[model samples]
Target chain A: MENDKQKFRLLDTLYILMMIVPIVFGIVLKILTTPQSEGIAISGAKIFFTINLPIQNLPITESQIHSWLVMIAITGLCLFLTHGLKEKADTKRQHIAEWIVENAQKLVIDNMGDYFSGFAPFIAAILSLSAFSSLLALFGLYAPTSDVNVTAGWAILVFFLITYYKMKCGPVVYAKSFGEPVPFLAPLNIISEFATPVSMAFRHYGNVLSGSVISVLLAVGLQGLSSMVLGKLPGFLGEFPLFQIGIPAVLSIYFDVFSGVLQAYIFAMLTMLYVAGAFPADEYFRRKAKKSTI
Target chain B: MLELAIGIILGSCALGAGVAMIAGIGPGIGEGNAVAKACEAIGRQPECKGSVTTTMLMGCAVAETTGLYALVIAILLIFVAPGRLVDILMETIK
Candidate 1:
């Protein structure tokens, strides 16, 4: 009992120290480093490759690097977790793996119906990738979703799937569907069809980019406020950014954690719904009938 | 003349962004109404909460597309448009 109490106390101290050390380090770093006047630059990928022959520069951006990191981390985790799987699950890792797979299956089944069960892997991958990329911003990495290109890539894939499924119904039916209810609205129908991917990509990119912009502004603003408050103090003490720590963390919770998860979920949910909507109308009714009968 | 042009450009962009944000009011009211109805439904039948929430979120997402359109416009006006306008003014002055 005493040993357990000692262990708890040690952990509590370690946690407190862990929290405080970062703030102290950040404050010291702030004092040491000159702050830039301009906020974070909104720019494209930095070029990493140079060709000697034609003098071509191949650029790799922060988004690509961070996304690659996320992919590697996720792949490593999955491999590590599922390394030793037995018929009878014993370890915590196996249990977690099973739970994740089961929930993903359930999500796909619930949203897209049993007829689209094959889409489970794709949906799971998108959900995990989106969530991880968004959460990457919390660690001060450039979130891949902040780039419109990344989101557009995902949206284009979804667009292709939606179009392909609609085309599968019949080329005549597909072409004629655009003119249905009123022939005059055909142009509008076609525009709206194209608008799907654009809107999806823009929605996600805008949310994440706005969140990043706001947080950067907040941090800079906080630093300014801190310097003003601390500037009154004598000598070296005036240089410290006292207000930089703890305060912005409260806002970060909402901007980073909450919004990131929500946007990721919304993006995945929209993708699933758009794809499911492309399935034949009769299949939906049939599924509904089956569920009702069961 | 240059100062006036720059001022006008910045002012117009700000005004446009503000106007774009006005689209938020629609989604605000819509999502509120949706959640309120979902809550009422859940109150009437607690067992249907899962389906009710999912449907509510889906409806809310559809409703939010208009707001997102406004946001995209606002972002363009605030970030991209200003820079291009400034560049154009510089070229004109040159």
Candidate 2:
């Protein structure tokens, strides 16, 4: 207990130092550096750095770096939560872990039925990754989901899962399934199948991108307004954007917090629904029985 | 001549973007109707609030797709179309 207390005190001091050092450095740097002429430059994710490949240059973007950071943070969180686990819940981390897992399992079971309880972890992974990626915008980082390619990649994976599950009934049935109701509708059905992933990708990407775009626009407008109104004031207060402080936070609550988490939840729910629906009623039973027999 | 052409192109792009945003009206109305119905359903049977809210949210999100599509088009017009149009015009002029 004595050793643990000493270790925790050391960690506390380290944490405080880590938090304060960069902030102090940033303030000093800001004061020393010349003020930028440009008011606010709003644009898409910048290529942070590039790697020279054999065929082409691989550009690592702001979104990509932020995503890596988010992944690392999540991994660290998981490690922290699962460390020193016992048979019984002796710690708060263990209790929290159990709660998260149990809730995820319950969500899958409720939405996609008991057979899809296996998908709980997958759903949880998507939920966490998507939500965390979006939430990064709150910290003034470019969100991965704001990049169409990232969301497209996830939507494509979900699309493949949906198609794969649908094909489990048999190739013949899968092919014929498109021609249902009438032969004339086959092309439409095929187009709709393709549209599923496209819409999913665009929906998620557009939401996050629009949020960031609007936020930037609002900040720029507010800054301009503030400058117009208070540019004559003495000292740093004149240059500083007073109006840009609290109002943008209100919009950020909706765009960054609510919309981000809501979209993540909706994406997960849609994935579950589409994948579960892909299985024919008879196929679901057959698969269940097969698993039981095995 | 080049300046006039550039102005014309940019003005058209802005106009197109504004026109595309009219698509938002449909989604706004549709979502309002959905919420109203959901509210009635909840009022009738408050016990099923969980499922009702879930279904309403799903429907609203799906309904918002058209508006989002329009938003994407508008964004493309505002940000992308002008540059491409100017480039093509430049090439043609050259």
Candidate 3:
């Protein structure tokens, strides 16, 4: 309990920081990092992707690096802020927590070691790529993930990682994955594998791309409404000592914080699930569930 | 002609954004579920509340991704769009 409190203090603080930094830095990123990307003409000439924000583009230009930095920073700060005490945990509670953590670690190590030595690197790469892409988009940056090229790269890496891990885990059955129970299905399986990356890429790219688009539009709408309805004629009418800024503030809260963090986690987790599922490694949580049920 | 053209682009963008936000239903439901589960877990086992909360938050965050994407697409469609082509096409037709 004591140790848990200490750990929780740091982690909770980190979470709070994570929740807050983006609200501030998101605005900052918008002004600074928005990319100056030119799209290619059909004739193979350069045309730029029009991103209005400069800083948002920084994460994109730097790919995953810039995004990770902000994410890590926010996380670190949140931990710093939420620092708690080291109280003694009872044996039962300590054992349970330790068991959960250790089991998870063991599963990860076994899967990564016995199966794909590169599993850790592969997952990290995918996560970094996504984190950066999302942070860019969140901050109103023109992002590579905004473009299909970067997304495709993400898909390709994921596809390869899945295949390599699968092959190592079940070389025979994996080979059988192609030219499986029936010959015709072989082509279909290939397509499915191919589709894995494409769908995964689109899913991540589409979500970030769409979220960026909507928040900006909503923000614009709210700002326009505020300027038109409230700011105008307020002084002429007799400026009420009580002003209501709450309506737009509520809208801003939902658009900026709640949705942004969720999207980043989803993109990263899907990548994790896809990679982990490929190895056919039984997850610790699921094992725990089964054991508890028994 | 220009006014009509701009209106068309802007209108289409707005329409598209509205469509994108329709996907928000997913995350809204998922987050609620996570919260509910977290509450239940907390009640059942207060000791592991911290870890449970973390896990719940992570799950909720993942759930929010789809909605976020919809927002991004809608934004692009509205503000940062391919310009002039639509206007030119409208002009030629007119």
Instruction: Point to the candidate with the largest TM-score.
Output: 2
Can you write out model 3's per-residue Cα lDDT over A145-187, one digit (the tens) per residue?
5555567676787678788767753577577668867978888
Error of 3 at B84 (Å): 11
Interface RMSD of each: 1.7, 0.7, 4.7
lDDT of 2 by residue, A115-138 (tens): 677999899999999998998777
Task: Give stretches of model 3 more than 4 Å off.
Answer: A1-148, A169-172, A178-192, A229-266, A280-294, B1-27, B50-94
Q: Is candidate 1 or candidate 2 better by DockQ?
A: 2
Clashing pairs in 1: none
Candidate 2 residue A259 Cα shift, in angstroms, is 0.7
Candidate 1: true contacts recovered, fraction: 0.58
Global lDDT of each candidate: 0.80, 0.86, 0.58
Clashes per candidate, residues 3 or more apart or on different chains: 0, 0, 53
